[model samples]
Target: MTETFVHPRAEYIDTRQPPPPPQPPPPGLAPPTSPPYITSGTEECESRWEAGAAMTEWEEKEVEEEEEEEEEEEEENS
Candidate 1:
């Protein structure tokens, strides 16, 4: 009797019910819309990010070239 009491309980797994459907928003308030200004701002941000990324890539290549030149100079001196 004690072993059966301690065994897994199927009733616990069967008890859960699906959630009810969501209620609609109230009638008076209109659904939110993205304003033109907001979209324009987003586009500006995207362009700026692209430009910044390109600049960073160019800078990295420049740095690598400088390092290579320095290494060549050291080798020539040695």
Candidate 2:
């Protein structure tokens, strides 16, 4: 007995198509006209930098206070 096998065509196996273009947002739910970062000026940037520096200073003071408390506790125990 002899058997014959037929291969499937490429079009039948792979029928992939290009993805559709992105759709615009609805009129009622459109994105903001101007982003916050784009509107921010040098003054805002400077204030943010100053705030970050102040936070670091505050953290250092907290660590120093904690160290002082630990030292006092050690002295009391000794």
Candidate 3:
């Protein structure tokens, strides 16, 4: 019995590619824009955070008072 072996085409397996030269994009193309309004994913994330929770005018006043008291105590100790 004789065995006949056939080889595959070379083009199908060839992996050599020239390193693509760096090129800038054409200037006329506009950048993609995101949706103007909040989406469902954004809404869920926002709900998880305290809505607009930040140091308000009253909270700032309390912090200022505490700091001043500490400064006065330091002066008295010296």
- Best candidate, TM-score: 3
Clashes of 3: 0
- Candidate 2 C-alpha lDDT tens digits along 8-45: 66336556787999788888986656556746444554
Q: Residue 18 of model 3: what lDDT?
A: 82
lDDT of 3 by residue, 1-78 (tens): 998676667338658998999776578966534465656543444444456646557656766787999999999999
Ordered list by lDDT, greatest first: 2, 1, 3
After superposition on all CA atoms, what RMSD does each candidate show versus the true structure?
14.6, 14.6, 15.6
Q: lDDT (0-100) at residue 44 of candidate 2?
A: 52
What's model 3's lDDT at 73? 100
TM-scores across all candidates? 0.30, 0.31, 0.32
Residues 1-78 of candidate 1 have per-residue lDDT tens digits of: 355565556556666788989777689967656564665543555555677744356655765787999999999999
Please report, as a residue range, the 10-residue window in candidate 3 with the lowest summed lDDT: 40-49
Q: What are the lDDT figures for the candidates, one per model?
A: 0.67, 0.67, 0.65
- Model 1 whole-model lDDT (C-alpha atoms): 0.67
